[model samples]
Structures are given as C-alpha cells and as structure tokens.
Target: MTAGERTGEKKDQCQGTGDINFKDRIASSPCVFTIGVAGDSGSGKTTFTQSIRDIFGEDLVTTITLDDYHLYDREERKVRQITPLHPEANRLDQLEHDLVELKEGHTIEKPVYNHATGRFDPPIRFSPGKILILEGLHTLFTPTLREHLDFTLFVEPDPEVKIEWKIRRDINKRGYTREQVMAELGPREEDYQRFIAPQQQYADVVVRVRFSKYGRERGTQDKVYQVSLSQNKITQSIEDVDLSIDLFSLLSLSDRNFLIEFSHEQRNTERSGELIFDGELSARMVERLEQSIEDQTQVRPISVFHNRGHVTATEVVQLILAWRIIHQRVFLERCHHLDQIQG
Candidate 1:
C-alpha cells in the first residue's frame, strides 16, 4: 500500500475489529464518531483540524493531537538524538488504547506536549464528544488505532510547500531557528518515509496539496495551499451533488475529486483543464451549506467561512468532513445498501 491508494479492503475484510457491522457499534454508542487524520509535518494537519473544530464547534468536537502522546518531550528527543517521527519516540500502544477507550465513550487525560518548554505540560481532560479528530503524523499509521476510526484522512503537500510550512511554523510558532528546523528535517526524513507516508494507503480519503501544475496556481505567500482530493467511492447525496456544482464551473473532474486553486487562474489551451476548485466559486454555496448544517444539527455556524467573498480549500474541506461526520448514519447505511445492491 502507498500514498493516494485506498486499502481496497472493506472494514468487514479487516481482522480483529470484531465485526463489520458498524450499525451495531453505532447503536451501542452513538455519541462518538472518530476520524483519524495523518500527514507529514507542515502538511496542513493542524489547519484542517482547526477548521473542523470551528465548524463542529468546540463543544461538539474534541481533537486529540497524537503529538501529545510522544514518549519523550522535545528536550528528551534532542538529547537522545531522536526525531519525533520515529515509532520508538512515541507511545503507540497507549495511543491505540486511548482511541479505543474514546470510541467506547470514555474520557482521558491526554498528555500535552509543550513545544515552548520542550516538555510535557499537565495532561488535559478529553471528554468524549459526538466527533473526535485524531490528528498527527502517525495517526492512521497504527493498524489497531485505525480500526477504531470511522473516517481516515491523509494530507500530502508539494515538497517545497511542505518544507516551507514546516520551516515557518517551527521558527515562528514552535520556538526554533531556521537552522534548527533544517537540521531536524533530515533526521526525520527516514521516519517520514517509513511511518508517515505509508499510512496514506490506509486512508479512506486522501487530500494532496500542491501548486496547480496543469491549471491555475497563483496564490499569495499565505494562502497558496491548494488541495486535490481523492477518496474511496462514497455514498453521496443530493446535497453532495449540489456542493460539487458549487466547486467548479466548466469543471474537469467529478464532484468527489477536484482541485482547489487559491487564485483566479483561467483554463488552459486544451479547454480540458484538470479539475480545478478555483477561489472564484459562488458565495451562495457556502451560505446554503451553512444553513443546511444549521438546519440539520440545530446549531448554526458562527459565520460563513470565506476569504474576501471567495470560498477556500480549507473551508470546503471542513464542509466535506462535516458532511461525513454529521450524517455518518446516512453515509454508513448508504454504503451498505450499495454493497447489497452490487452483491
């Protein structure tokens, strides 16, 4: 299995999960829905999770960043000469146990990795919620933990873009210098190849962020993070179809898979551009979805998410994740129904 590839096996096909009947599991504990998200450093893991935290509202969703499960604090990692990417550097078994417990609607005192102090802060309480986003580098990498996740997401960005994000974030936010950022990246590279990238094969949804190569690519320094999406064939609704209509005009790809361009880049000479979700999409769509979510969930979002009246990749991806989590019963039923029809 590799990045951008689905495991190609159904949950029923996997061993040790007990049974393939998610409905029974849902019935047993309907309150908790967990999504396991994995991506390399600076690949928009936190940004995407933040978007979800906002859309679902903090009260309804809980995010457990697996970085908190690091076996060694930052200083310890440095002293041991180990990067955070290695399996040896993390408490994988404990992470798996915590996720299993969360799925069963249990609370946990999850560790807090303090980047500023290079140590573990006092653990924070994680009460179970309707939705849980487990976001980090090795999130979907562990098989046992993967089983407990209802949705699995993987994000991989263009190499240059990823490096730029990592460098900027480490220096500005995580208290590191440019030289230190560069130094640690080399050490982490091997672990990334072995642990991080391989998890993508298990991802139910894969989002690739890159410079628009075949189509529009222009973006300012801050907002250039365009996204490409692929997924296991999903059970989409009328709302999903309408959402697709909203993403691209003169679209090249299906609604389920499209590229979001951050700037106003026009189509090429071929007239057959790659599926582009340029920033110039309609505003009504966001409003429509916002209203739909409010209607369904009985809680309106704080405000419609947009940048200068243009819809963003970050915002739309948040909607897609919301669609998956909020109507998970619909998604799961439709999938099984489709399977029965096909079988």
Candidate 2:
C-alpha cells in the first residue's frame, strides 16, 4: 500500500516522490515521469544517478541500470564469442515489461548482474517511486524502450577522457587489472559503434563532457560540460532561459547539428539554467545550481565530494542531470495545476 493510504492522509495532487500507486493517482500525479540516461560503460552513469539519490532522497526515485540484463555470465559470453554490448546479449524484452509494469504502479523483482563474479545473483524486488530512471547503453537502441521515457539524456565523454576514466574506474573500483581494462575497451568500442552512439539521435539532451583545451594548455585535465539542449523535445524556449553569459557555439552530432543554448537565472547565488563553464569549477556551485528555484519545491542539496582543488567531470555531469530532472518536474507540476483549474 502507498504511504498515504497507510496513514490515511488526504493525498492531494503532488509532484510525486511520495508512496502512492501512480496509476491510481494518474490525474494528480502527472509529474510521475521516467528518465532514461544512456552511454557506453564508464560514462559516469552510476555517479550521476548516485548524486540524484543524494539530492532527492533515497526513497523518491527508483533507478534501474539496463546492464544487469546480460543474458550470459562473463564466462558464458566468452565461450559464445559474444560481448555484452550486443542486443542479443541482454534480456531487453523483460526490462521493457518491468518498466511498463512500474509505469502502471506495480512492483517488480529486478535482476542483478554481478560483474566481479561474472554471474547472475538473485533478483532485488522493489516498488516504483515518483520518478523512474532507466539507464543503459541500448536504452534508446530499441524503439519500445525509447517510447517509454519522458526525457532521454545521452552522456558523451571525450574519447580520450573516457578511456582514462574507464581505466581508473575498472582497475581501482571494480578490481579489474590493467590488461583486462584494455581488452574490454576494444570490444566495447566495436559494440558502441554498432549499438550505442547511434541512440544519441533520439536523445532530448546530450551531455558532452570534454577535457577543456582552454585550461592553460597544461598537463592537467580540468573538464568542461557542454549540456546541449534539443529544442525539438523540450517546451522551454531559448528566450525563457536566464543564463548570464552570451557565450554561444554550435556543434553537429547524430546527423543533426543542434544549436547550443545558454541562459541562467539566479538560483541561490549561482547561475541555474542551461549555461556553459569552461574553467575551474567548485563543488558548491554544483550544489547551488541543483537546488534552484525551478524545482525548489522538492529541492535539497546533494551531498558533494570533490578533490581539494576542483570538481571532477563526473560530478559536473551529475549536477547537469539534476538540473534537468528538477526543472522538468516543476514545469509539469505547474502545467497540471493550470489544466485542473480550467477543467
């Protein structure tokens, strides 16, 4: 039962994130949206989602990583001469089914893929929350999956930077040796070319993370995050964006060169909106941007961890997503109120 149902609270319309069956409260819970973030491995998907959990609170959002759908264990994939990136390697149909059920206000026992043991563990059962986040490489690869998302964010870290990040993460965090990391990258690139990067064409937002060459031409790798907003899907106009700097640039990707948009409204002393930053960044800037006015109704600062001197590219991307998620929520909530009053 929903939290409101158990406590007998008069649950009126809300931006969701409450314990309520979404289907039963569809009219009051139009903001119960699903977000899909897709990219190749080590593109900071886990880090980004972790930051959201910190900000929105652990119980507000339900996150599902598509990687756990691997049909074969590591040894099984090796024996079959197949990599996990291939569509055949994953149980996507099941993933779609569970997401559909979750969308309709049902619980699901999601599968768990254990990387260290190269095997499948028991499934973890859970109910859906106000927001559902579905992330993986092939999330947009399939039409069925794409149709289910309210917002799609494609993470594009620079090739060189991604490799560096992958090596560090796999070896240091995942217990993989240097040699294993290299071997994995080659097959991953092949898989990406075949199945991953192509999905970016359908994304509503493409988060491009690159080690900025503008940073003093030094040996250091301070990064810049260019969050390109696709004007086609989002309802917000460029005129409405309140970013300060007029620094504008255009770039092409996915067979369409999307115009980069920028603006920032003052949100807690920091510029909040689709804006650009190319130099050193502070963790506090990220926190302030997240708890912006657009979504401050449900806003709370995410606990931040950074290096002594600067914030990492991964951290910045998380804040970018948090910005998008919160803004989308606020927009929907207001729109729904207007619709109800008219009705």
Residue 250 of model 2, lDDT score: 18
lDDT of 1 by residue, 234-295 (tens): 43332432353453534543332234433222222111112234344445456666666555
Question: TM-scores for all candidates?
Answer: 0.74, 0.71
Give residue 76's lDDT in candidate 2 (0 to 100).
90
Give the runs in model 1 whose Cα sits over 4 Å from its true position.
1-30, 212-222, 235-240, 244-276, 285-303, 306-308, 329-343
Candidate 2 lDDT (Cα, 0 to 1)? 0.61
**Candidate 2 segments whose C-alpha is farther than 4 A from its true place:** 1-31, 49-51, 214-234, 237-276, 281-291, 294-317, 337-343
Residue 311 error, candidate 1, Å: 1.8
Alpha-carbon deviation at 130 in model 1, angstroms = 2.0
For candidate 2, what is the TM-score?
A: 0.71
